[model samples]
Target: MEVLLAVDVRNELRRIGWISLQPNGSVSVGLNDRTFVSPDFKAKNFVWNAYNRVTIQYLISSDPKALKPIKNPHLTFHPPIKFQLRANGQHMLFEGIADLNIMLQQDGRVPWIRFVSKPVSELSKAGPSWNPDRTKILSIRLGNEDCSIGLGVDFVRKDVDVPTEDLLLSEFIDWQDYKLYVHSVAIPAQIATLSWYHQK
Candidate 1:
């Protein structure tokens, strides 16, 4: 599917407290390292654009749905984005903004925006040919300008010891920091399971 990502510059300016564009108002969105035709090559690298704006495009075999709706939408991504799809031909993972829903108040101050991810069970059931390990899905939260809150899920492959990685809307997470901010959350196996257990 062809997707157009339109960002509200006005609101983002207030949140980050600066304009992303250069004095000439040019920004380049990088699509490096993010280009993934083969899943085995997961290169976590990106180039920066001095320009204030940028655009990126990529092709993927699968696209996941939003597991949850975003409540606050005052966030945007830094340019030169590389979108990569994991080796699983069935799953496509990108390193761009996980949450883009933002609202601008009349006063000009940018409020907290909300970002959400789709539940693993929903995505697995929605598309049968594409069986994704939803436990692999992660929700990462950014606070202030430096600190980050990582939320990990217990869903894992019993067979493979795939190292746990950090998920972010930004370009990439540093290898060292991944050890600190990462934490796990429970990913329900299925909606039916929740209903069945609640009844008891």
Candidate 2:
């Protein structure tokens, strides 16, 4: 399993010359070059209907989608392939979201969605007390009863549509260890273990 990174982003479309204050004191807004259209009514012949006299100002806006969209190369996600993590013993189910990344593999032009095997990099405000880790570390150590993990995963489904793709999220369970940056945490001479295996 591979750990992938996902970041949320938004693109701003509103710009200068797109909005202006008319001499009549009305706020005129529109897509600089696009014609305005809207779902509203109302017309009264001010010249003929003296009873309907009233003042009105207009502030036009467009639907979010109607505004031109910007492409984001960083976003390669599409309909998520399904995945489930089940731990050994008592059949406890581990749940997670696998922010799927749709990619074209070298094996063929066919698209594939990669599963996240670890918690996504931080931006989390849930605080340290919130344990959303979905990795095998915890699942593989339930009260010292001896453990292993079973994972079920599937590839991109044929009928999946791009308009409303199902997204997934993966969690962090445990790590044999994590690397330290800025400085070395250990050296070969200070090692205690001789071989690598899942942490006990």
Candidate 3:
């Protein structure tokens, strides 16, 4: 299953001050409660433009080893999934689980599960560019999944001029010896912009 989630930037800005692009082309980003300053325009622009406008996508699946049929299961037991966005402190952007519904097939021997979420808007408010030297952290808790939780970080770099090398980071996590999951990938500007435009 695929889960799409968004960060509420308006609320996040309220909790943490807004990022700003200085007149001198410098960037000021508020993480936690402290401000970080940087001289990289591309990095700042990438984060500033993408911040709240970007939506996160997660690919979810059942643990292969734990997929045995159950004799009896609770039909209404939907699990809660929580996520946190933090720069320096906590930016409570989103917290909730996908709406899940289960139905029995006509054969009465099979079941189907459907997950849904309300549409999210793709609007960008005013903000400064992002600083490539700083990093932003996002953590997710998949409450009932075998892999209970995971962490993702947005790191910016300007040392490399090639666009392909701009977003270069990947990580994996192992859960209970049951799954080896790709935890995170650095977001590229092209992908981020596409994601923002895709949101309605």
Candidate 4:
């Protein structure tokens, strides 16, 4: 399946070149870690004209890393990007300003990124609580299942003020600072899961 991702840059966060997405049952968005993220990879999102502004083709079964150009300069944060994904002649719209984020780490930077909501300080003192309004609505599976990774989209709607998504998280729980399942992604069980167990 070839999926097309289109977003409203005016109403949301600025979109960059390498910031691409492959629509599978996972996180379908990609951030341009170094090249696009910077001039300075951490502070500003300085992308160039070489970036693919609006044309994206995502095969549900392709390797996220296998896709050229989209696999480098990984960013540290993935906020819920509002977009309309079309696949199989179906259009899916995701609307919300995101406060939930997943930091994408270098393949070997630290094995995981921070999954945070409120400040770590607040959650520690008050204990952790799950909110429906805050149920992450991005279908970002941490491990792969013979599928592609990268920033792909697979969301489920849990009832609440906002919809809850399946983060497919495990291993550690810090509440406000939920330990990461993965900073990078792939769809196949071989690619992501193997890396998760072997490298981690």
Candidate 5:
């Protein structure tokens, strides 16, 4: 049986912009643009008069057909793909909005969704935590029963999207072993098309 990352990301699309938080994570989505079309109250007065107005936002996911293994020409490291997620709030909000809410009303479910995997270079190392640039190590463990696996993220597109990856050990190990495991398969990008409330 394959164990996949299971968690729901709830987003609050408010007047100013969209706000969301993962089940138990601090990383949240914020605006990366301001091209969103504002509601035209004069032309369609009833639309804005309604309570709990539904403003649509675009969600981008990887094209299942786009899934391809990360072929490295240098072959320095071939880490297993780790499941990860990311987003640029500004880009998604504008694109989804300009699409006339088509992407947000997907089968009455999520609008646009994609799935893609990440490269293995993101896996955590087993040796001492020392950065050439002297960046302090955040967490030394994967926050699981065994500390072999570690969770790391990839900033595929700084403002447009984010990819989340997870590291996993191939073999089970005791905590004392302190060995690193092979990263799990990376989860393709998923569009999080969401409806929000516009603050006017």
Candidate 6:
């Protein structure tokens, strides 16, 4: 899955820009002639709204047939693309928005991509408990069992007894990066493992 990043100002289509991913893994984004500077002007406060909205589009495939209509051909990013945003001069890391996922179509032809705007109370409901410093396990009660899984952690807990049958490890590889996800929730205790995984 590839992602393309674009942003538009409130109530104006004329004021729009894109974040381009360079071959060396650096990014170039600009609004008109003003280019975005990292660790300085970070992208932050992303919520879904009509004004000043950021659109994250997914490029399903690179085949010419998949590039249908050819509108704005530059909108796309290879999977595992990671970066940080400065929201209003404050350094807002990408992990701050880990809870959000791109909303995709159900037809299965294309995957979902997310659009973000300013934070609102209603939007918080859909967001995850984001903590860049700590990993969280979202729990649910299934009968008498405590079913919970860790997010933002790189390794499985050492003390927990994860059922071999229930454990799932999956990986997503792209041109620039690779990611791994482990699903093992049948364990009974809270476990702490390594932090996030990033491989070039």
> Candidate 6: which stretches are off by over 4 Å?
1-80, 83-90, 94-141, 145-147, 151-164, 168-182, 191-194
Q: Which ten residues in a row have the lowest lDDT in candidate 5?
A: 72-81
- Model 1 CA lDDT for position 3: 12
Ranking by TM-score: 6, 5, 3, 4, 1, 2
lDDT (tens digit, per residue) of candidate 1 on 28-108: 121101111333422222443233323333322112242322111111233222223232233433343311111111111
Candidate 1 ranges beyond 4 A from true positions? 1-83, 89-180, 191-200
Which scores greater on lDDT, model 1 or model 2? 1
Q: What local lDDT score does residue 115 receive in model 3, on the 0 to 100 scale?
A: 16
Q: Which is better, 2 or 3, measured by TM-score?
A: 3
CA-RMSD of model 6: 20.6
Write model 2 residue lDDT over 1-200, tens digit each, in one string: 11212222131111111112223322211111121123332222213222332323222222343333211101111123222212122121222222223221211112211111111121121112122342111111112212111111122323332222222222321211111010001111210111101100
Candidate-wise lDDT, in order: 0.22, 0.19, 0.21, 0.23, 0.22, 0.25
Number of backbone-clashing residue pairs for each candidate, in the order shown: 23, 12, 7, 25, 36, 13
List all candidate RMSDs to the true structure: 20.4, 27.2, 22.7, 19.1, 18.5, 20.6
Candidate 3: RMSD over Cα atoms? 22.7
For all predicted structures, in order, the TM-scores are: 0.17, 0.14, 0.19, 0.18, 0.19, 0.21
How do the residues 85-120 of candidate 6 rate in per-residue lDDT, one tens digit apiece? 322333332321221112111111121221121111
lDDT of 4 by residue, 9-93 (tens): 2232112112222233223333212111112111112232222222222122113443222122222233332222222222221
Superposition TM-score, candidate 3 onto the true structure: 0.19
Kindly give the stretch of ten consecutive residues in candidate 4 with the minimal lDDT sum: 191-200
Off by more than 4 A, model 4: 1-68, 71-73, 78-97, 101-170, 173-177, 182-200
Model 2 misplaced regions, further than 4 Å: 1-11, 14-17, 22-26, 33-200
lDDT of 3 by residue, 70-125 (tens): 11111111121112222333232222222111111111111111111111122122
Off by over 4 Å in 5: 1-52, 55-57, 64-200
Q: Which model scores highest in TM-score?
A: 6
TM-score of 5: 0.19
